[model samples]
Target: MQGSTHGIPIDTDKSSPIIVDLIYRLKIRDVMTSTILSCRPEQTMQDAQKLMKDNSITGVPVMVERRLVGIVSMDDVINALMTGTMGQPIEKHMSRQVIVLEDDMPLSFGISWLDKYRYGRFPVLNAKKELVGIITSRDIIVTLLLEMNKEIERFEEATSHREASTSGFHLEYTTRRFDFEMAGRLSTETKRQLKERDLPPKIIRRVAVAAYELEMNQVVHSAGGTVRVVYDGNQGRVEILAQDTGPGIPDVESALSEGFSTATEWVRSLGFGAGMGLPNTQRVSDAFSIESSPAGTCVKVTIATEERSNP
Candidate 1:
């Protein structure tokens, strides 16, 4: 194999190749160049060409009955032109010989296959054979670079989370039988962490808002709860757990509604009974789940360090 200009050594000329670790971990989801662009196998070659031109891509996956059955590249088109075939369908010229990888497979196997087989790109699919993503040499290289950076960041963060968790500092608070005063405290703590770590403000805000609402739900309805804050340089997360032994809300759907509250008169006096708690919590969280029972209620909230757009 020929080494890339990027100074990556590859025995490209060899029939059998082994990929190195530096190149393997580059398949990290956050980093990876992929062509989400695809074309149906039955589509005309012209349509396939149009898709490639529009996306500025050299190749496109071929789908049949919504399943990835093959792939077609620019080289296929050239072969058609040279053979006096211009108006053929994609399936007629596309390479039915398909190669794929799982999302969790190490980048090494993918790289080795690519090098040994002389493929420009490969599709990434799950066990269900669903087309989740694509991987190319460029994508692999980019992923490698990103993994290197993320590794350093994770190491730094591990040190910080350890220091904070072991700082021998204890902060505790008690919530009344039914009150929401301490609901925003966890969020405030998370915000402070974001500012201290210089995380993106937009992402921090979303995490904080989500954490606060989850915290408030516990305080307002549950018996009590606690929050543990941790930060690792690349990301920060907050874990909040609230629990109580009370008759849980009968209808989870109504409880999750915006502007829906069942607070008693005394509880509502604190301006804490707005029905936005559950809905707002879900809105701000990257992942949201709930479980409850009549005997007691428990809620857990988590906040990520990175910013994500609402779904």
Candidate 2:
């Protein structure tokens, strides 16, 4: 960081950890400008200069057909102007010893190359060694700033989620048909959320069980649905809702009955569709309701925690 190539001001030791991660995580292709203005080697240096001027760029890569052969920078144009050589062909005046960056390299590598060479820009090549784009210090800075802002937003949103568990909060998630892999995610999330609160273990277990059963119901029984949890901190209650676009349950009574299941053979083979999902959810809840139709089915369950507000 101390003896960096040049122009790049990032010091890994002192910069935010998030920024350091970004430099390493982002690839050259992610930051470089894919839409590039290039010049044929046979074109006049004046032509490259005009391209730079019109585009407000400091450098341009010189290409021979599709191959990148050289680059002309602002200094090159200035020298040509001072020496009255602007009309000379690019191939004759362009710096032929071009330093290039590969599209797959990390942004950290680009930062190093830019500082190491102190060049205005670097030609970007693909795995096939084809010229694809170009990179500059400005691009790295702008992209890092943009990505850092996004990370900050995510961090803030997570903090808000933790806070919402104490206040009145409603969280919703989409569940897919037969997505057994994700079946317990909402329940696990519920456990994690309640564990941070002052609620008793019995109350927490009831909420987690209700969440898991409802989430599993959507994954195994419903075509697909949304699972929602609303915590009424003032009333010391947690409400869980499973609403599904459905062919509708033929027997709502059978669905609520213990040891009753409509799940197919394949679902049962996966150790699901035990017919206990709705029963378990309803057993753990202080309030329960179910509505079914050809259009959809919605089940709501509420767990009453201790009569206390969040600390």
Candidate 3:
């Protein structure tokens, strides 16, 4: 089974630049909860249940000093309770066959293991093979989202420094508001063109994301707009412009905030706007900007053609 790496369901090998960079950048040790509450081998099953209840957790590692001996899940406790064994020592009912994640392993490995084992959490072991912390799927999710938010904020701060470049190729497409069906056509075409030109996969992905976000913003929020693509073959840069005719965004500052949007209820139900458009575009682009007025809104994104897109 494919491991989901993000809230939007990402693959370990392929995903948004922001996410791929994040998963690779982080390690299991960084995300796991270091302050662990545990149950000892001699502790009763009833004790494990209480520990879980008090901490709002589903599983407790049975520990001997600093060593992890086994894990007793809520399921084990329930079975023990129904079978009238809640009074039994936790070690007796705990799953002796433990799966663990190494502290130094990449977060991607943790994600895959969580998916593969279908476990609610895994014990984390240091090089000396001592239990250092515990990691859960929820832990992975929360860290990624929080880190992504911080990274996006950093990108937004850099948007004022637009890349200085000259254009080599140009193309434009008209986008109708609420045109969900055809919304991604421009980015799709742009990606294919870049791929045919033998551009690096990494840069191609950043350009595709920048173009798609710009295109999607116009389609989902603007009245009607034009998506312009300017590819500089010399510098290997892709500049995209998404400009709408009218009914401009009332608050540009609020619009740029992630998870803030003006998309209608029906549009949101279709999953169009969780308010990541501008943030995502700005995040992927090496240079970005947004200008709006009662007449219209225009978003600009620039991604370099170099293999190291951001550098």
Best candidate according to lDDT: 2
lDDT of 3: 0.84
Which residue pairs collide in model 3, if any? 236-305
Give the alpha carbon lDDT tens digit for every residue of 1-311 in model 3. 24554432476456677877778679999999999888899999989999999989999999999888999999999899899999999989999999999999888888878768888999999999998999998999899888987887578435522442233556677889888877887787778667767888988888888888878888887788899887888876888988899788899898889999888899889877889988888888888888899899988888877766254
What is candidate 1's CA lDDT for residue 310? 69
Q: Once model 1 is optimally superposed onto the true structure by TM-score, how far is the C-alpha of residue 176 displaced, in angstroms?
A: 58
Indicate the residue-level lDDT of 87 in model 2. 92
Per-candidate TM vs. native?
0.43, 0.52, 0.50
What is every candidate's alpha-carbon RMSD to the true fold? Answer: 17.0, 13.7, 12.9
Residues 1-311, model 2: lDDT tens digits: 34332544676767778877788789999999999899998889889899999999999988777988888888999999999999999877889899999999889889888878879789999999999999998998899888987898579559758678455676677899889877786777677667767678999899889888888888887789999988887887999998999867889999999999888999899887889988888898889999999888999898888843753
Estimate candidate 2's alpha-carbon lDDT, on a 0 to 1 scale.
0.85
Model 1 lDDT, full chain set: 0.67
What's each prediction's clash count? Answer: 10, 3, 1
Give candidate 3's TM-score: 0.50
> Of the pair 2 and 3, which is ahead by TM-score?
2
